[model samples]
Target: MSDRFDPILLSELIASHKQKIADLGVVIRYNESFEELEDKLPIDSKAALTPHFATALNTYTSANAFWLGGFDEDDQLVALSAARLDDLGGQAMSEYLKRYWRRCYPAEDGDLAEASETQPRFWNEVRGRVAYYGDFHLKREGYQGRGLPKVFGPLAMLVGAQKWDADWYYTWVRERDWSMRYPLAYGFSRTYFPGLRWVKPPSSIEPDLAAGVNSRSDVLDWMETLSRPGEQALNK
Candidate 1:
């Protein structure tokens, strides 16, 4: 999609979200190093770095991917998110995944053949310059019920769009996260069940997954709603 946003309005909305998080006693930093980010992730994190952002195996320059971390009063990393440009050009998302499933999520004796058969019908229609946001984590101790997702969701998409001019934003959501209705909280408008059907799934990761998607137009409209005067968008 074209960059149709008002720079001033975008800046204001981004600042507003950052301020909201700061009020919760978290400091945000735009990190350029994925290695540092991988190191900073909690050792016991169930949501470990996916192969999409694995620096050891993949090279992500500033133009393609970006990561950020939030720190508390003691400078401890408490929350984090990352986004990357998945340039599909004219290929369907389902086809792209089928071609790169092992590269994206490497596992021995894995089965990804079901993707071609069971993927949502919309996957064939979704293509071109997709911004994939993932690696969202929170420290659970004091972050829950604080409305951080509302802030992080929009802020991450806006930044990704600004950098990549992505047509669509998508991510793979865990089954539990979907059950909790976090997709709605994250400003995603559409969700598809059984986004990826693995026949021989790995025991290390959550087997079931759903897809969260938002068109650039949808995100722009959401920003417009949030930027309206007296809206109090993030709080809701």
Candidate 2:
């Protein structure tokens, strides 16, 4: 864990979030096995598992990445989220994405090269240690409207912050999910429209996305908020 924050307060904040979700019959645990974790993800007609966290495509270990699995009373995996450290010493995120867009979204092949040219203004400001978050999936059967995200999302980012001390927490989400306020529930401070675009994008993934962002200060403030009275547990 990073030493930038108070250890005592950090522990308390994490415990508080854990307890809040525990009431919903969910137990959260950290895992480093991306290969196994990927197998556990729900296989549905959504965007294919992101290559950013796929073990076959990229490298993510205990040293630089972490995945959180939320299981229920039956010990069945129901929610998933992961983050990885993108250390760009002095490079802009847009430039980095331009070069790796194919690696990150290999499923989209036709006109994939066009993705490199599309950049949101906010992308230029992202630099240094970045906690690139993705691979978030939550079953909708019994977990949709129970306020799982209120705690789960923040808890994921909190764990990411502890591990990376990242300058920013960033992700690209479907525009519909953004319209549904998923990013806000995930603790991102800002959301930029048309984050990533393509001229003839494949139908497998959304052609456009809303980029979610959360600065280090924003994360710290969230932890402080949870430490206060009446905010220890989120409402259902």
Candidate 3:
């Protein structure tokens, strides 16, 4: 739904990278001809639709989304990640934010339900100026230590930035991922705590952290190395 980022293009770029990843012994696929996968995505899960999931599905349904899957050499799904773009900073946007954010983390510093109180400042400062990336999930088994985040993170932001020309980008990541230093290397604050979670990360582990970036850097340039045929077509 965002005018700034080309979800379709990013999806294509990701899909084309599958062969390169395959060359490394792991085959990955990004969204290509997504509509054909409609029956494939929601047919297996039966978990209770939590507010968070519901909202995420809504965002996923929007045009600003990218889905990636890492398949075994046999073509079985081993790892996957999905991300969506969200904008904040207006009366309508504030309400949409509260609808889902309150369920997870809604405070300036781990407060857990003050989004309304902070809506003005959030709206005033970041509304329309910033873009948020959320609903990203990556499984651990088939893709460990393979530098997925380094590639995916910057690519997502690049598409987001290209679409909106927004001031910054943010995402919620578990504490462990935060401790790894990749996010900080990409330009997000390492110690900042914008929101505390209630049931996020499934309540059995550490809370998630909201990380963000304001501009491009060398870390983003690393994405250039990931270029493949899918992206080449975009340039022409």
Candidate 4:
């Protein structure tokens, strides 16, 4: 993973993703003035937009950028996706993440402190840096397979690769959830991280992506096989 990422660089990645969404006929606006932002994207009522705004702002404040999904023509929100640098702190932000972790993982496994320790090892073994990439949503009506991942996942990866200097990227997904299929299709593999629980979304579609041999496993095999071989071994 590239190790030079900072807050500003991360923000640029979010901006680029926003542009891509716009190109796809979606509107992704940042709340420059929190007050104006609040006015434009109200949260008082019980609606999808409230959580979307809250999650987006929280991610931006903590992680540099958030990609909130919405339709341009109708101005309806469809899904939310975001990433934050591994550092950045605040009670609200911590609490927000805690809630998601609790929802996504099992309470019996352990607390956050124990669970967080696995991150470094996971990164090293997987050859990827950790970036939080959830809060994904898709309105039931607008959901379609054709362009969603192309619109968000690769954009996030490009942003992560460029800004964060990340060689690889990782996210937590529930085992049974169909969304997990998207990452696998994109070359992410399942490695064990303790204390993470797999939660099922209310409804999910089976993922449709090309599959061949296990790409991640191949990466590991190449490293193990070529660590020091033949002439190199003889020289050593």
Candidate 5:
């Protein structure tokens, strides 16, 4: 895709979103423990990793939780946010993920095979260098302009800074999602694979390659303005 984001325009977009949030009295807070956050958010059974949700959360060695909610004069869980973490283990991780991919995407075997073959290459590109923002969910009825994911820009950056101190971050989204634009605002570039790509390992390990793809410039522009409120042209 060609450049669609102008830094000034993106700043305005983010500012507008923030203004909408402030007007609604919405609050965003981080949850250090799963128990605290779980009590509030609804469980998504249709999630690709539904069966392993709790296991994944509980087993995560480097995970953070955040909840976006609204309260009256008093506090309560009116809305929520939930996300998990995973280290894309080279070949071993690929094997582990294949099982889940097979279940969630049974018909995608050919794509998975190709991903597997490229696993070593991809992992070498990612590995300890990148952190995957597994999944994020927001309540349907929460006070909304575009919903929490649109506002999740700062939260994701915070998580990355505190947990991984990562150079880059990545997440997979369904092909048709409108939210795909949100990540770009936060500086995550999408990878273009010919088919659904699976993580595969090389027959032999080789030197790591330099990072290539990245979030589009417009997305990066928005990300840069996140920490500076006055600099932010977006509402909020």
Candidate 6:
């Protein structure tokens, strides 16, 4: 829980995180409340309002996307990140992101149509609360190595899980990108199901092949490092 963190330690961690990026000639701002972030996304983020990036913007039917932003010298929104806070404790979790896509895009693709039809089956294996770790975007190249992922990713997870009061955490990564995703989600187990995948590039992280956490301790343990180079399980 947020209470477990030492205020001074957390503040120091934040300052250090900012300094890492600032050293690369960038500025960062972390917003704890979704209200301030929901008001007019940055110019680079206008693509998100179009529904394709809604999940990245942290916009969900019954939830707000806890977000963080990085900007260039002129403050023009160079990098932005977010995580989804929604209930997958039951049918809610099943819909997770698919619902958002359907509501906004409305059966635009072959896979989405199939996913819409296959939604019920996907829910069968989903239960308990779930938080989605996603919506990370770097407007420009050469910035990822600036320690931004380490700085923003976990902080987004920390805030989003706290915001939604969720201990169940998960994220999507296409199988094609396994090398990158698996390392980030070390403590989560992959849950496979029928048609439980991204509708478009369903293979993006492999459908139903998503990762999840069962309790707060796991979330906390993982957050201790976010992702260690070769962590084999929830804990040593």
Structural similarity to truth (TM-score) of each candidate: 0.87, 0.87, 0.54, 0.46, 0.53, 0.60
Score each candidate by Cα lDDT.
Answer: 0.76, 0.77, 0.47, 0.40, 0.43, 0.51
Off by over 4 Å in 4: 1-24, 28-63, 87-129, 178-180, 185-236
Clash count (model 5, backbone only) = 19
Report residue 173 deviation for candidate 5 (angstroms). Answer: 0.6
lDDT of 6 by residue, 1-236 (tens): 45254445444445655676687777877654544444536545344433334435434443545557777887666666656555554565555556655444333343442344345454454456666565566654666555556555555555554456565666544444444554253334443323244445432223444433335555555545533435534432
Worst 10 residues of 5 by lDDT: 203-212
What value does the lDDT take at residue 19 in candidate 4?
A: 72
Q: Pick the candidate with the highest lDDT.
A: 2
- Supply the global lDDT for candidate 4: 0.40
Error of 2 at 108 (Å): 6.1
TM-score-superior candidate, 1 or 5: 1
What is candidate 5's lDDT per residue for 80-154, written digit by digit as tens? 333444444453433444554444332323332223444434434444344445435443444445554555554
Off by over 4 Å in 1: 1-3, 43-48, 106-114, 229-236
Residue pairs in steric clash, candidate 4? Answer: 1-167, 2-165, 2-166, 63-84, 79-137
Q: CA shift at 116, candidate 6, in angstroms?
A: 7.5
Off by over 4 Å in 3: 1-20, 32-62, 87-96, 103-124, 159-167, 185-191, 196-208, 215-236
Clashing pairs counted in every model: 0, 0, 4, 5, 19, 9
* Model 6 poorest 10 in a row by lDDT: 186-195
Of the two candidates 4 and 6, the one with more favorable lDDT, higher being better, is 6
The digit string of per-residue lDDT tens for model 1 on 1-236 reads 45487778778887898899899999988876798887776723534587767787778887788987788999888888889887899998877876666545534455432234456677887799888888887777888888777787767777776677678888889988888777767767778777776645544457688999888787777677778756544534
- Return the lDDT, model 2, position 70: 91
